[model samples]
Target: MKVEWKGVMPAVTTKFNEDDTLDLIMFAKNIRAQIDAGVHGIVLGGSLGEASTLLAEEKNVLIRETVQLSEGKIPVVMTIAEQATKVAIAAASDAHENGADALMILPPMRYKSTDIETVQYFKDIASSTDLPIMIYNNPVDYKIEVTVDMFEELLELDNITAVKESTRDIINIGRLRNRFGERLSILTGVDPLALESLFMGADGWVAGLVCAFPEETVAIYELAKAGRPKEATEIYRWFLPLLELDISPQLVQNIKLAEVATGIGTETVRKPRLNLSGDERKRVLKVIEEGLKTRPILPDYKSF
Candidate 1:
């Protein structure tokens, strides 16, 4: 399916049972709400989804369930990340077979990785399935830099049609748009940088916080796409802090807390990634309260 690189694409959180099992019921409801909110697409099991902690079967199951709930109303993009080429390919293919519209793959995490190695890892995944591929480069999370040449090479692979540049380097985004021009769709993953990416020639936003406030995120993207930067910037100013919340040390905890606050998904993140404590919890809640009070969900679309 050809995706519209226009509005926001929420990387929907993977809800889990108290026993740390996949909660398909809430996940399906979240998927339905994204569709109702009129988002461009639904990104399942991505960064906000805590893809790292989920088992392969759980990941596969989540994607399959998302496909079923989506009911072809929206494109389903799965974040399939791995250090092994074969495993990444297998994951991408699995996502595609289970009805994912696209597969976003992160660079293979390595101790001392090179651009050549990163490009090859993606190529390995690209050759596996016909799904449109979006490159995920979150240097903060993955701890690797994707050189411009690596991006250029990745673009040569036709299936590699988009990128989720989660780095602070907005210049690299402009460089890619300058070189590749219309060949690829660049989607910003870093929520705060979404405005910068849109201004610099990105086609869309693959937002993590969108799970908490899809309506606002979608509104911002729509305004940006329609060339209303002034209004979009106003919305972004309100969202900047919320975007920064994902980078918090208690990232998963903050994110889940915010989602629960907004009445989206549960605050149940798996272990090894613990929930926030004392001062950290208070700080996170404070940020959420301030963001909500100031922005206030547009007075409508608040029921979600």
Candidate 2:
């Protein structure tokens, strides 16, 4: 269950019942779909997984359940997105105890820490645990960018082994590859940029849209890796609209609706976040329905 930091690693959504309780049954169902579709790993409590509303112990439960469901076939990574370094470190420790194979950690939430502080934050968390860590570097949305200079300092820790590159700056992938070589693994965190990122030398994808469209997502990665761009572009062009849904402020609700459309999950979300409604709901549904209507017959990309 060692995290390879390569291939399609889903930043999966959290399923909830009408009463706002954890829907382990539905959660497992969606994860099973990802595993069957040939994902490399599954990430729990990510931004797409509604990490902000999740309780500490609840995360442990998720890690334990996902570990059980994956059954050692793939790695189960827990995301630590906390405002306090202490809390982030504790969460990382707890994930270690609960069988998480690795962790995806964000910069200090809410407060925009300086580059030095951010580097120290990640360093402290990595020092606190033995598990490998994937630094979530999304300055576009999270406001604290883990720049290449900062990464130079962070990579001093052996456990800081990978990065979830979400800066939307495609060139950063090449920068990381050129600077780090094989010292760090670069996994694209942006869905719309996934195919391009792979072509730009990313090792994998930390995907959001794959929660519903796992097979198509994996197909793009595999085909691109196999040097079959003609086949991969055909699907990536068709998948662009759906992939765009993962970049929004309401990505959690949007992706949940996609899951429901694919018949793999429910639409219940935590408070402060409701299901899509009005024109937004109709628009998202239109996109989902149209994608399903024309869902491509995937080639034998797996065989390659």
TM-scores for every predicted model? 0.92, 0.98
**Which RMSD values do the candidates have, in order?**
2.7, 0.9
Q: Which runs in model 1 stand beyond 4 Å of their true positions?
A: 47-49, 297-304
Candidate 2 whole-model C-alpha lDDT, 0 to 1: 0.92
Candidate 1 residue pairs in backbone clash: none
lDDT of 2 by residue, 170-274 (tens): 999999999999999999999999999999999999999999999999999999999999999999999999999998999999899999989898899999898
Top lDDT model: 2
lDDT of 2 at 252: 91
Candidate lDDT (C-alpha), each: 0.78, 0.92
lDDT for each residue of candidate 1 in 1-304, tens digit (9 for 90 to 100): 7865545788777798999898888877777777777787888777544787988888778878877877777788888767688877788777877778888788875554777887778887898777888888778777877766787888778788887887878897888888788787788877767888888888888877877887788777777777778877888899989988866556667777888888878888888787778987888899999998897445232232
For each of the candidates, give the backbone clash count: 0, 0
Q: After superposition, how far is residue 56 of candidate 1 from its true place, in Å?
A: 1.6
